[model samples]
Structure formats: structure tokens, C-alpha cells
Target: MFAGAQVSLYPMADGFVGVILESLSALDPYRDQLRIETDDISTLIVGPPEVLFPALRDLYCAASASGHHLVLRTTLSRGCPGEPDDPICDTSCLANPSEPLAQRQANALETLRLAPDMGQVADAQFSLYVMGNGDHMAEIMGCIDFLKQSGTFYKSKHFCTRLTGDAGAVFATLQQAFCQFGPANGHVTIDLTVSANSPSKR
Candidate 1:
């Protein structure tokens, strides 16, 4: 499987150059776990979901907290045809990982609270795993309905749906989708990949 993200962060503030550099530095520590490449336009990171999500959360949280208006734009892809395979894309790395994405989100949310309001656009992809018995298709449709009403959404051929909206609201909606609908009887899990960008095309 191929799992990777190409991201670009723009900090809108005075002395933005240093701010951007410092903000992007947050991903440096994950060098061992991911294959990261940075160029003139964006940074591309390839790895498994376990490491990918945490790294993205940390990087976004740090960049948003930089006391400046920030915009993050990214294109995330996985399982695309003709893609190269990599070991890190497998689920084995997460079998016993110490920290998971849910935990990382808690921390990211804390930091994101301090970020100023800038009317940014956050885009994300989610694959809801509907398990257990009882109207799985109905439940999936329900989730999709809510998301569609919540913001802009696109159903991709890659088997994931994309959503875009205000950063806070987008994540909050996602949290709700992940938490509430998976009732005690029904089981569901979501794999999410998110990105944000300011001054987006409307």
C-alpha cells in the first residue's frame, strides 16, 4: 500500500520566513519513521497511518500556535495505482505503538485553541470502518449525510471521502462523527488524513 502526504504551510504574519521554517521543523524528529522530502513548494511524507497522523497533528498544532495566521494545504494519497510499496505503509508498526493518533489529537486540540481565528480552510479524508451487525450501510450513509451538510465534501475514487471547512469546525465535526455514531452495538473506526490552507479557491 502507498500512504503519503504532500503538504505546504503558509504563515501569514510579519517575519513569516523564520516562522515557517521553525514550524516545519516539527517534522524533523520523525525522520526515522517516515520518508520526508522538502522542496520549493511543499513537503512530502510517506509512512504508515500511526506515524503519519501523529506527525501531522504535531506539525499542525505547532504551526497554528505560532501566534500568526497559518494556512496548511496538502494532498494525501494512498493505494493509488502504480504507486511504489514501502514497509512503513503496513499496519504492523502500529500493533503495539505506545502513542496513538487519538492521544495526539488531544494534545493538538489543546494547542490549536490558542491559535487565532483566520478563516482557514481545512481539508480531510476519512474511511469509516463499519463493523458488527445492523444496518452498516445506513450508518455509513448517515455519517456521510452529516458531513455533507457540515461542509464541502467530495467522494474520491480512492475509496475515501474528502471534506473542507473551518479548521476548528472541521475537526470538531470529525470528532463527533468518530465518537457518537459508533453506538454500543455497532462498531466503527475511521482513518483520517487532514490538511488546511488559507486563501483557498472558493
Candidate 2:
């Protein structure tokens, strides 16, 4: 008869409502019975089983599409449901930054090292800018993806990717990640650093 749902979105984006709809569309379609409402803060949905499941799925999907790490929880009842669950209550759904920064940085570099080679060029050091808002986990993941997907370099485990690349290539990679950051780029700042040993003079 009634239920409470809580949806929290991080690193909010433009057309966020659309992202939510797209996400919902991917889930069980019987959710038409539900009545859903969302504000800048969260989304609240109510109705029977036929309605709730689909609504919840959309909430999950939209957050995912917008590059937001999200969490949703439903409290069921006979008449009325309370607010949606807090993202912190569910560890699995929440983004975590419990790992040390050094570990995160190392993981980013390791991802860069595993890519295919670029002809004669060697990808030396990876300069990753954990761009976007304060959602550290998402930004870390973003940096990792940029390192691996961009055509600038290949993967190597022995040496640091940040220490060996062409200067231009490294900057290009940093620029790409910054661009993908979207809204997160507003409140937060970007930083990228790389170091290469001195080469012999011409």
C-alpha cells in the first residue's frame, strides 16, 4: 500500500532527470503503478509492488548513467513509506575511499601500464588528475579508465607510468580525463603531475 524510498545522487549532472528515466527503463517494466517524485535532494516513490520495483531500478540506472555513485533503499508498509534509505547505510552501494591515497594512485598507474604499446613511444609515467567533485572513488575510477582507454600509452608493471612518457602525450591524457568529468569539474579542481628522468643532451 505504501513505502519509503531514499535516493541520493552524487556529483549531480545536467539532464539528471533524464538519466533517472533511462535507468528506470532498463528495469522491470511493471512499475507503472508507482507514483514517483524527486527534488534536487532525493527521489520518493510510492505505490504497490507492481510500481515500486521498476521505479527503484530506474533510480539506480539513472545515477549510474550520470557517472554518480548512488544508493537506494525502500522501507515497506501498509499505508505510508518513509524517506529513502541513506547511501551510507548500505556499504556495497556506497562509494568508498577507505583505501590509502598511495594505493589508489598505484592502482591508477598500474592500469595505464597494461595497455597496448604505441609504436616506438613508451608510456613512462601516468599523470592522473582525480578530477570532479569530492567523490573520491568515482574520480579514482575515472582516472583509471582514462589511463587504460586513451591511446597515449601501454601498460608496464616494472616502472612507473608517471616517470617515462612523452610530455605531450601525458598532458593530452590529463586533458581528456578533465573533459569527461562533467559537472564534478565545477566545485573541484584538477591536478596532474608526472616526472621523467633527465635524458642525454642532443
Candidate 3:
């Protein structure tokens, strides 16, 4: 029951320090919501998906707005097997003292709502490994259908489906799939990977 990501941000421009610093600064507001660690190579963020995705959305949007070439690559996962238990694994945030499921879905939906139609901005891709369901195949297919209709998913793969179109729509579709099919009992898990690159200014 753990969710985390390792991210590398590359801003392609002369003396890119300002852009990099600006992007890192964007995470400051999200510090309380995420478990963040940065070093020489990349930054690591760990927390609930409800909190993590929006932080990514805001951070990336701000970074890409620099009018400089930038690439943000990430590996995100939840309920991963053999991942050691940590504070980020806490389930307390999944539910409220009151109507837990409703609140959880609402929080998850917020992430999707923040997604921007990156179609005019960037072309990106992400992968999801949806796990732990008896009717998983049907649910998975439904998710694929949902993505296809959204015009964000490009093709289906064996282990992961490749996504396309606007970065925001792609992310929105991904989050929507997880929120709709993700387990309510905490028995299911999903592993995700995202790459935001290739400016659509083509």
C-alpha cells in the first residue's frame, strides 16, 4: 500500500538554472501534501494519488510555460508489491471521519478536473497497471474504451496502454480510470509511468 514517484526535470535552454529553480519552487506549496526529496539527479515524491497528481499537474504546467523546451519524466506507482511500508502508505486520508468513499472519489476527481488539454501544448504518454480485481478484464476493457473515446489514448499494449493527445486530457483520462476502477477495499493497486515531452508547437 505505497505510492511514490521519481521525477527528472530537464529544461532545454541556455543557462536553464532559472527555469529549473522556478519549477522546483512550484513544489514548495505542495510540500505539506507530498513526501518530497531532491538531490543531484532527480526528485522523489510520495503520497496519496489524490494529492500527487495535482501537484504534478501544477508543477509541470508552470515549468512548461517558461517558453523553453522542458521534459518531465516520472515513474509513479501504488500498492506495489514488496515496497516497504512507509508513512506515505497511511490509509487515513482515503476516507473521512464521515462519508469516506464519497470524499475519496471527490478528491480523486479533483485531480482529473485540473488536467489541461495539452493537445496544443505537449504530447505525452503514461502507463497504468491496474491490479487486484476478479472482474479485472472487463473493468480494464472499460477503461480502455473510456480512454479511446476521450481521444487521449492511442493504442493498447499487453501490460500498459500508450496514451496520446493533449497532456491534460491524457492525465485526466488516466486519473479518471484509476478513480473509477481502483479498489474501495484497498485490495487493488496500480502502477503508473508518465513522460511529458515533445512540444506540440509543431
Candidate 4:
């Protein structure tokens, strides 16, 4: 049940160092709940999805509040076969493997509806990977359907889906995509990039 994320933040501003350091404060509240370590490249946050996603949302919103173009790149994973199980990652939130896909999608949408509004807009593109055996595409397609129904959905793109809205809903959608659809104890991962205050808008 090990789960975590490797996150790197890029701020398009002259005071990038300050922005980065300041944004990190957003994770203070989650420090006791997560094992976080930062080096030159990225920060690794080890925790359950329940705490992981909100920590990410707050961190991103803090950076976005600087009014500078900001980009957050994260690689999130749960139940990786190669990783050792950790007690810190324990949680009851993952969808049951036997749960019907339609039911899972319904639950995901309901969760999104209750996501908090962070007052910051985010545009994100990501790909969900449900690793290991079983009908992978079916699970992926079911997640895609959930995303389309998610209010944050922006559009579909090559190799990934785009989502736009309040940072809360967007991150919640990403969390659902990671938590639902796949086997409860199976390996699942997400490659995600979220942007805010970008100068160019298509």
C-alpha cells in the first residue's frame, strides 16, 4: 500500500528561489502525516492519497498566488510492485477491486463535487497508468469517462487528458483517477503537469 509523489516546481519569475521556498510552507501542516524530503531535483512526499493530494494542491496554490507563471510536475504512484509496503501509507480510501466500474465513476464524481475551492485556477495534463494484469484499457477508459464527467475536464489531448478549473477540483479529479478504476491493491501511477498564470493560453 505504499503511495507517494515526486514533485518539482518551476516558477517563471526572477525570484524563483523565494517562490519555491515560500510555496513549500504549504506542506507544513502535512509534515507529521507524510515523509517529505527535498533535494536538488525534486521533493518526494510519501503518504496516503488522502493527504498527498491536498498537500500538492496547497503547495501549487501558494506558488500560483505569487502571480507568476508556475508549473508543477509530479509523478504519483500507489501499490508499486517493486516498492516495499509502508505502514505510513495505510488508508481505506482506494476503490475496491470488485467494485463495479460504473459505481466507482459515480463515487468519483461525488467526491469531486465536494472538493474545496482553492481560489486558484489550474490547467493540467496527465496520463494515468493502471499497471499489472487484467483489462487495463477498460479501466483506463472508465477513468476517462469519469474525467469527462468531472467539472474540471478541459479536453482530451494526445497521450493525456487536459483538466482546468479551481485547483481543488482539478487535483481531486487527478486523485480520483489515481485511486479509482484500478485494482484496489494493484500498481497505479500518474504522470501529471499542472500550470498556473501561464503567459500563453491556447
- Give the best candidate by lDDT: 4
In model 1, where is the ten-residue run with the lowest total lDDT?
Answer: 92-101
Q: Which candidate tops TM-score?
A: 4
List candidate 3 segments past 4 Å from native: 87-120, 131-139, 154-168, 182-201
Residue 14's lDDT in candidate 2: 62
Residue-wise lDDT of candidate 4 within 152-192, one digit each (tens)?
Answer: 88899999999999999999999999998789889999999
Model 2 ranges off by over 4 Å: 11-32, 66-68, 73-202
Could you tell me the lDDT of residue 34 within candidate 4?
A: 98
Number of backbone clashes in candidate 1: 1
TM-score of each: 0.53, 0.28, 0.69, 0.98
Whole-model lDDT values for every prediction: 0.61, 0.39, 0.63, 0.94
4-79: candidate 1 lDDT, tens digit per residue: 6787877777887787788778898898999999898988888865566556666776776665667666565554
Tell how far residue 117 is off in model 4, in angstroms.
0.9
Name the weakest run of 10 consecutive residues (lDDT summed) in model 2: 87-96
Give lDDT: candidate 3, residue 34: 84
Regions of model 1 farther than 4 Å from truth: 92-202
lDDT of 4 at 18: 99
Estimate, for each residue in 1-202, the C-alpha lDDT of model 3 and write its tens digit: 6776778778878967888778888788879878899888878888876667667766777777787777777776666666766776465434332344344445545545556665334445555455664566655565565666566666777677776656576666655665555453433444554444445544
Predicted candidate 2 versus true structure: per-residue lDDT over 1-202, tens digit per residue: 2233444433244665565556555444544455556676755555532234334434443444454433233332222223353322221211125554444445435444543322222223433333234665666465555566455555634322342344334433443333333232122223222221213311
- Candidate 2 similarity to native, TM-score: 0.28
